[model samples]
Target: MISKWNYLPLSPEQDAIKKKLVRELSLSPVLCELLVQRGVTSITEAKKFFHPQLSDLHDPFIMNDMDKAVERLDRAMGGKEKILIYGDYDVDGTTAVALVYKFLRNFYSNIDYYIPDRYDEGYGISKKSIDFASENDFKLIIALDCGIKAIEKVAYAKSKGIDFIICDHHMPDEDLPDAVAVLDPKRTDSAYPYSHLSGCGVGFKFMQGFAINNDIEIKKYLYPLLDLMAVSIASDIVPITGENRILAYHGLKQLNTCPSLGLQSIIHLCGLKNRELTISDIVFKIGPRINASGRMQSGKEAVDLLISKDMEGAKAKSENINQYNEDRKKLDSQITNQANEIILKNCKDLDKRKSIVIYNADWHKGIIGIVASRLTELYYKPAVVLTYSNGLVTGSARSVQGFDIYKAIEYCRDLLENFGGHTYAAGLSLKEENIPHFINRFESYVSENILPTQMSPQLDIDINIEFNEITPSFFRTLKMFNPFGPGNTNPIFCTKNVYDYGTSRLVGRELEHLKLEMVDSRSENIMNGIAFGMHEYNDHIKSHKPFDICYTLEENTHNGASNMQLMIKEIRPSE
Candidate 1:
């Protein structure tokens, strides 16, 4: 993909963070500057980031419908009612199902899990699920990572005497679902301070409230559930700030040592044990396999594996998920290549439009969002990639940092049949014929609202530290900002004129990474480095000279050895 090279600098705002850090933390200029650059100007903020805990979490009832949801959950556990945990088919939904199924199963054996099929039932709560629950005498249904827009399904469940509770984070419409308790932070009436909880986070919170109310030792129950929340948080691309930071923070901590059966199967397959896993691991490695089970086959498979009890069962489930991921990878690559070709041939008039919307009768709906991501990478604009068959159109939209895709789609209300997503990601459906008008209208809407400055990718560097100032001790203090993601990101700094000592070929399929050695700019000490997706730039980078680049400090481990290394983000070849 041809990504946009435009970037937002980190100098001006960073200077202010430094000043604030000096006054607030009462520290030396260098340390204070680092804190400020990381959006931690106050001493309190720094303390919290370093030591995130359960106390930093928001009150679960603050989310709209928490009380009602809790009431229904209490009733289910109280009466030993047969409960079905319903969820979507992706990583977020699968993790949610696992989190709820395991938590609830501890108190009630009548608990079972269900994930709707992507092709069969589409997204969210379904009539088929309600019918299944009814047939099995399941009285309580808790919908996770989905059900925010399931008004008809919720009503149908209620009529059948099946009380419903929703633990979701998707944006909701004007009319809320009539479920007995609808827990969603994105609801307009929601007073939850942070609205970016992933589906599992809401599910976790619902369980958290129940655990606290019952005096079940929230940490004992909740801590074990962090790995699930971490997977969802990373997979869904939510901001890792406030409550989310704490969730990802502790989730990652336990993720290293205490993966659940399903997660352990997946982690063992990835050869990760007693290792510090980052958000990128789940994003690129683990999340894909879990999501693949839903996209390529049945979402329920991933859920089954997640809630699997024994190693044998978990391994069997993981093999299925692995197979699906392998199939998905082939399909995704083929479609992405074709979509890129489609854009190159047909999107000549793209620069004039504010958005990119493409539809191919043959495009696979399973990977349209991946295509949308590819389109955004190539075009630097909000994009919607769709597949049309018969009269129905389903598509995925990926937005730039400045564009709120769901809100932008709201402007084209007349053309869409159904639409829902977060600020930067969304999914929608409409008739094939209405697409052109929706495309044209959505373009106009974006052009009117988005600013030129907002089009550039913002790189928020936490601090500017020379290579000499970096020491082994700083890594420990830096990890105080543990569990980095959207809000609490691993620090990136600018280093100028680092010495280059060539590189060794990092052998991997498709040349996924590169390894090199360089001399520290300030100390004249040698340092090891690795850069991802940099093989194509190898010639430009290693063209017989030293280079200045932007990178981040990272810990690299291999063969029972640990060492700090620099992960280069970008490089400028000498002119």
Candidate 2:
């Protein structure tokens, strides 16, 4: 599919800010422009952005109910109460559970962790888990990455003499749970300065507050667990800015230098043990392996691997999780292909449809989110992929850029038994018979709310620059913008008048990728680039034709030699 290129040139005000920043920092105008775009108009702000310090994170107690949460935690440990660490089934949930459990285990002995089975318990705080806690004499439950909306369940736990301390980042409903403490950054009355924390980030803050309250040193106790925080932040797709940046910046350091045994084992299994890691490595490689355990089997297995103490045992567990990842990939591919076929055959006037709601009872429930994502990528529309699970139609929904799938799902809440998620993604369940009504309502809502630009795939080019502008020093500065994700994305540069040198060729197994040695009109330097799935443009590129390309710069290592390589996003023949 051809993509629309969206480039916004700097306005006068932005240009003024960029020039002022350039003057103050003595940096390239382009670099200044990027900084200014990120709302860093001053030199101090730039320094903080590039050099995130752990000390700069907001005071954890500033969040609403944090003091109460910490107090309850202190009381639980003081009384030697059997504390249960509860979390969701995904990467964020598992990581949060692991982080909290690891920290508390250092001081407290009467503690255990629990991860609800995805199929058996569904999402969030499950009644079964509450009952299990009650039966196990778990008097206090510290719920991580979830439980902001467990009103009835928390009440039930309260009746059973179990108190709840919720550390969650998801948007909370108006009526908060009657837990001992509800710690969510998104709480309407929250005083927390930064609100975009991942579920695991909230858990980290809770731990931070707990340590501060009890006079525990943060550097020795808390900093070491940032590896888990980094994985959670990246895998959960949270904005990497403010406190998150500090957490991920240090978390990555912990991950690279001294990862826990389980993470190290998984890193070695991923073949990423020797190299420096990035957010992409976590998102694509480590996170999936961790998530696969939950997707294919039990999430508790993931927490077990995360908190493993033995090296050999962690390796064995990593191997098991890797197999689950492999299984998940196969299932994901099959389901995505099947979903595509269903969409193409049943949906007439596909372009006219504002959203997609496809149902297949035979589809695996665990992999529908991936299928929904695939549908959004292929069709460029909000998509819901549903399957029959225990007499209800349950599934995941993925939205295109700028569209809020969660809101769209919530708009049809009367038809849904339960639903919750962020703007771009969500999960929902309803009566099997409500599928048709859901499709219509979801589509109508999207049609009314979604902008036309959202229905088309667009690549937002950061800036235009010639190949000569990319110097070693420039690339080094760019590398300082590490740990990029939703908020702080890696820059995308567009270079025009690019010609493929004679050495360019098709490199992939099916000859479906362009491995290009490119040079532009302004530069004599030959640039190596890869354009994936763009084989149709290979001949056009190789026939001495000049084309404009937009790409993000990445380092490619081949046989122990590293060089700058452009991961090209789009290629358009010069008009």
Candidate 3:
């Protein structure tokens, strides 16, 4: 893998532009400079950065069927009608189910939820789900994380006199189904200002309006549930700014102080020793365990854990979730190794192909997307991983920045039987025979559109400074950019001259990491570093050449000993 290390390279034109913004805004040079760095060069743009508000959210009634959907839900709650929620089996889907499930459970005792079995039902709303909704006497049905593509199933449910309200964020086709209300910002008719909400966020917003119309206390009832929305936002890789940023910020605050019983148990299980839990903790230490349930079997168990009221129920579910996570780790490693071997041997046109569309009839459909995501990161290209079982072909696609993988698939829609997803990720199905044509045409579309320069990942450097700038206060100041994710990123600082001047050791049994010390008495500060997943380049680093290092400062603690350390991201021989 080619590691990227970016330093803020300045030009005369850029400096002049920065000076102009600094003069016009009457803002601190630091704030103005940062905004200029972000491509905002005037006070009009600066107002947006300095003042963030909830009024920025789009009008709730502007979505295609928002009024009708909210009206149907209001009726269900008022009449004590049995309400059933259906969702798919991923982190986003499960979290969406939890949000809607808990929100409705607050108002009515007749609320219940269902998540499809990954192996048995595959993806999206199924005929079985509609059948169950009708038979159970749930006059009102809410579909989360899916159902935008279920044309036939929605019609089937409508025929049974059940009202369907869809809360999905995927790209929509020209023809919508016959649901009572379809809520997707991706639709052409939607006037929602921000089109990038996680599935759970959409469900939460639906509840936000429902609470307002019903004259319920929204903060007391809804805000505490944001922890689930936060997890879904990170797990689904949604941009974490605007409404999402506010939701995640409040969600972390809630988890740190007062959390749901299920979340509190999982928090203790994950070993988050600090009371200050950020988005990183949720993604790295926790989200995978909740997701492991759906990936291996049924996501219904996860929803059970989220809504479990009794302490014993929460404990048992947490223990099972932890074990599932362990199993996921083992299976993921095996699939990654096996898939890599197959690609190296059989993918002859890899260099020439635009998007990777690989399928194996014998491969496990449950793990193909995970393996496919690994492939995209390795090659820096759009990737599609597919598997076949019972005469049906199901596949998942992941994309790099600046390329819309969903749009690429739309170019070949005629060849597909069913599909739904957003800009960077999507899921689709087809006849087993269409694989070859898909591979050819999809690659042709990518090759024609993606420029060679654009194929390289965009490297963003927050700000650059020498090792002399290292301090506890400097780390403290960087907290202004907290709650980082797709929209906000951790600051990457660069120091040009550093000498390893010691043996570089590869750590871990698989040589998964590198550890080394760089001393520079020639400069004002001294430092130690650990570069994760960089053992592949140890031989080149052992030679005596000064290196440029990019890293984030982190505090290390062990046995009451505490000091600053470097979480080295990348290293390059000095230019």
Candidate 4:
């Protein structure tokens, strides 16, 4: 599919800032302009952006109910009452549970953790889990990644003499839960500086508040769990800026050097041992394996693997999780194909539709979210993929770049049994009979709100440069923009009027990829690049014609030699 290239040149004000930054930082003008685009105007902000410190993290107690959360947890631990750490069944939730459970288990006994069964119990603060907690004589339930909107479930737990302290980051409703403390940065009344923390991040802040309240040393107990924090932030697709950046930066350092036994085992399984890990590594390789456990089996298995102390046990569990990931991939591919066939055959007016709402009663409930995301990417529309489960139709929603899928889901709340999520993604359940009404309402909401340009893919090019501008030193300086994600993305550079260097060829299986060696008029450098699924352009690329290409620089190693390669995004033949 072709994509529009959207390049926004620096404004005059930004040009002045870029010039100043280039002079002060002694960096290239293009690099300075990129920093200016990221709102780094001065030396101090640039320093902080490049070198994040743990001390730069916000005060945990600044959150509204953080004091109550810490005090309640302290009282629970002080009295030796049974404490249950409960969380949702995803990467963010499981990591939050593992981080909290691992931290508290060091000083407190009579503590346990619970993960809601994705099939049997469904998502978030299930009464079944509450009953399990009560049956085991638990007194306090610290809910992570969920329970901010569990008004009735918290009331039910309260009736069972179980107090709840919710640590969540999803957007909240007008009425808060009756829990002892609600720690969510998205809360309207929240004063916390950063609102984009992952669910595990909120749990980390709760632990931070607890440590500060009790005067426990942070270096030994708290900082060690940053590996889990990094996983959650990267996997959950949270904005990697401010406090999240600081945590992800250090968390990646920990992962590369001395990760937990569980992560280390999985890293070995991924064949990534002895290599530096980045946010992309977590998103593409590590996070999926962790999520596969929750998607295929119980999420408690993921937490077990994450907090495992024994290397052998963790290695075995990592193998199990890897199998689950393999199974998940098969299911995801099959279901996505089926969904595509359904849309093509049934929905004849596809172009007129602004959103996608597809249902397959036989679809696996755990794999629908991935399918929804795939549908959004394939059709460039907000999508909802639903499957039959426990006599109800449960579904996952994924949105386009600028659309808010959760609000669209909430607009159909009266028809839904339950729904909660963030701007770009969400989940919901409804009676099977209400499926038609829900689809119509959801489509109507999306059609009314989605912008015209949002329905198409656009590649935001950071700057246009010549091949001569890409030096070894320049690439080394670019490496400092580590741990890239939603807010701070890897820069995409475009170069025009470039022709293949006569060594380009098709390489991948079935010859569906382009392995290119190219040069431009400005330089004799024959840069190497690989463009996947662009075999259609192979002849044109070799026709001695120039084309404009936008790509991100990546380090490729072969036979112990490392050099820069362009991970090409889009190619436009010169007109």
Candidate 5:
């Protein structure tokens, strides 16, 4: 899986701006270049980027129909109407449901929550769940993370005398659902400044709006909910640029200092307690466990773990959820291996194919999405993992950096019974017979539209710098750019004319990692670097010749001492 390295070029004007920022902030030129590349040219922008504040969050009322949504909720609370917090079965949905349910419970007690079973009800506002709400005498249903596309289901609930207030962030269809209020910033008419909020972030905004309308301090209700928002933002893979950044910034603070009992139990269970957890910690460690509940079993258990107030109850639920996560890992690994084998054996000319579409009727639907993502990492192309269930071919799709997978799937809509997703990921179902045609059409669509560059992975190098710049002060300033994600990513710096000082070794249980004592050719500055899964480069580095490397700086603590280490991204022989 070789990738093209794209060394970003800086214009003279941009260089001049970086120089000015360097002079104004009294920072290193390399740090200034990194900031300039991220669109932080001015000191004001740098201040906001480096020091994100909760006060910087936008007003929740800026979202369209926020007032209506809040008013409907207030009415429901005043009338003691049975309000149900409805959400999807994933982490974003479960966390959103938990956040809203717990917050509303603080003020009103006539509230319960519902998470549709992934295997039974599928995704989003289902007809069966609506019928349950109708039969249970529930009058108000606040759908979180979903319902933006549930026009028919919302209408059905409406006919049953149930009103809906939807809080979703997905791209909505033109014909909006006839709910009492739609609280999606992605709504074409929405005025909210930040539109890339996670589902839980949108739900938190509703709570913010409710607090404002009630003349109560918003922080009293909002601060406690930041942990949930952080988990959703990280897990949902939303852009962490605007409000999402603020929420994640503060939410991580809450998670480290005083997490909820459920979160605390999960942290303890994962052995991540007494440490500052990062977005990656939540995304890889915490988020997966939370999502595993929904994927392997009932998502209600996840919501239960999230909203539980007692330590004992949360611990009990955490143990169960942890086991589910363990089970999910086993299945995920087994399915990924099976999918890889299928691709290797079936696809003769893997390079000629623009997309990957593999189907196994016996494949578990719960792990298809994970397997699709895994396949993309190895194949470096759009992948669709399908399984036959209930006489239909159902599956998940994952795309590369610049590809629009949902649009590609939409091109084959005639063959697909239903499909929905954004640019990089989607889900679809079709008849068994249409599987071959859908695969051909989808492959043809991708081959015709996708660019040559889009077919292969590309690493975007932020800047080229010398090892002299890797100082304690420089690393400290870089640490200000915390909570990195899709929109704002960690800076990848390329250092030219670098070589291992006769101390490079392959380290790791499988001897698959390259540990190097890298030295700068110009400054003779030394830095320890580790390239995980790059043992193939051991001979290249041990040659003692100058080479170029791209990497990110990370603080590695060992034996009670902390020092900066380069986490190598790519290595190349110097030209």
Candidate 6:
């Protein structure tokens, strides 16, 4: 699909700051320009960005109700009261449960964990879990990744003599639950310095608070839990800035150097043991395998795998989870194809429709979210994929970059039985009969609210650079921007007036990848560029036409030698 190229413009003052940074850091002007674009105007900011330290993490007590949560946990542990760690069934939730449960088990053995069944209880705090805790005589429950919206559930648990300490990162509603302590940085009243923490990050802060209050060194727990935090942050797609960046940076170090037995087993299983793993590896390889367990059968199995102590046990669990991942992939592909066919058949003019909402009663509920996300890639608009579950129409919603899908769904609240989510994604449910009305209402809401520019995909170019600027040292400096994600994204540089140097070819199994050697128009300098899944552009390169390209620089190693190459993002005919 063609995307609009958005070249970011910098002010004269910003240009001066970039020049100063180039001189002070002894870096290329392009690297300095990217740093400036990321808001690193000074040497100190650049240093902090390049070298993220765990000491830079904010005090956990800064979060509202953190102290209370820690104290409650301490009191429960001291009295030998049965405590339960309750979490959702996704990567963030399961990882949060594993992190806290593993850490607490080192000192307290009375604590247990519970992951609600996705099909039986759906997301968040479930009455079934509260009933289990009550039957098991648990006095305290720590809800991870979810519970901010569990007002009625918390009240029910409270009525059953169970206290709740919620560690959620999702935006909370105006009326907070009556839990013993609600630890959410997104709370309007929270004083936490960083609010973009993942659900596992919030749970880690609770552990930090507990350590601080107990006078135990926080590093003892913090260091060991970093891998889990890193995985959670990467999988949950939280903004990798501030404390999240520090956590991911150090966590990745730990993950690469001394991962948990479970992580090591999975890495070995995926044939990624000897190589340095990136955030992409974690997101695509590790995250999916872990999520597959919950998506297929039970998330508790994933939590068990993560917290496994022995290599043998971890490997055994990893093998089983791998099968689930295989099954998940098949279902995902099949459902996505079916959903695409539905969209194609139902909507004759996709551009005219502001939204895409399709329902298949036979669709697997677990794969609908993935299907919805895949649909957005094809249509470049807000998409909702629904399936029948428990006699109700439930589904997931995914939005494009500039749209607030949650608000759009909220606007059709009358048609929905219930719904909740943030700006970009959400979940909703309604009667099967309401599907038509809901789809029409949702489309109308989006058409009225969404800007025309938001309909198409966009590629944001950080700066324009010459082929000569793509040096080995420049690529090395770019590598310092580790653990890239939402906030700190890999910089995309555009080079204009370039043509293929007689080495363009379509590679990959289906010839879906474009590989070419590009030559600059002015200086005739050359660089290799690869555009994955852009085989459609082979003809233009074959014609030897000048084109502008946006891409990111990466170091490619072959035969023990390394050099920089451009990972192309977009290509456009030169004006």
TM-score, one value per model: 0.90, 0.98, 0.90, 0.98, 0.97, 0.96
The segments of candidate 6 whose C-alpha lies over 4 angstroms from its true place after superposition are 509-512, 559-561
Worst 10 residues of 3 by lDDT: 48-57
Q: Which regions of candidate 1 are displaced past 4 Å?
A: 1-31, 389-391, 453-460, 501-516, 519-523, 531-546, 573-575
Error of 3 at 526 (Å): 2.3
Better of 2 and 4 by lDDT: 4
lDDT of 4 by residue, 386-491 (tens): 9998888999999999899998999999999999999999999999999999989998999899999999998899999999989998899899988788888999
For residues 1-575, what per-residue lDDT tens digits would candidate 3 score against the true structure? 44454456546777777788768865444444556665666777556544444445556766667788889988887788899988878888888888888877776788889898887777888877778888899898789988887888888888998888989988777888889899987788888877888888888888877877778897789878888887888888888766777677667777788877887788888987565677888888878888888887678988888887987889899899899888887887887787778778898977777777777777767777888888888888899988885578999898887788888888889999888787888888889889899988899889998766556655566666566666665555455556778876666666776777676678887988888777653673657678988886677667767777777767676677777788887777777
Candidate 2 residues lying further than 4 Å off, grouped into runs, are none
Model 1 clashing-pair count: 3
Runs off by more than 4 Å, candidate 4: none
lDDT of each: 0.80, 0.91, 0.78, 0.93, 0.89, 0.89
Model 6 weakest 10-residue run by lDDT: 468-477
- lDDT (10s digit) by residue, model 5, range 186-287: 899888998899889899999989998998677787688889988999999988887888898999888998899999999999889766799989989999
Compared with the true structure, the alpha-carbon lDDT of candidate 3 equals 0.78
| Candidate 6 clash pair list | none
lDDT of 2 by residue, 392-440 (tens): 8899999898888888999999999988889898998999888889889
Per-model tally of clashing residue pairs: 3, 0, 0, 0, 0, 0
lDDT of 6 by residue, 31-148 (tens): 8888888889999999999999888888888889987898888889889999999998999999999999988998899989999998888878889999999999999999999999
In candidate 5, the residue pairs with backbone N, CA or C atoms under 3 Å apart (3 or more residues apart, or in different chains) clash, namely none
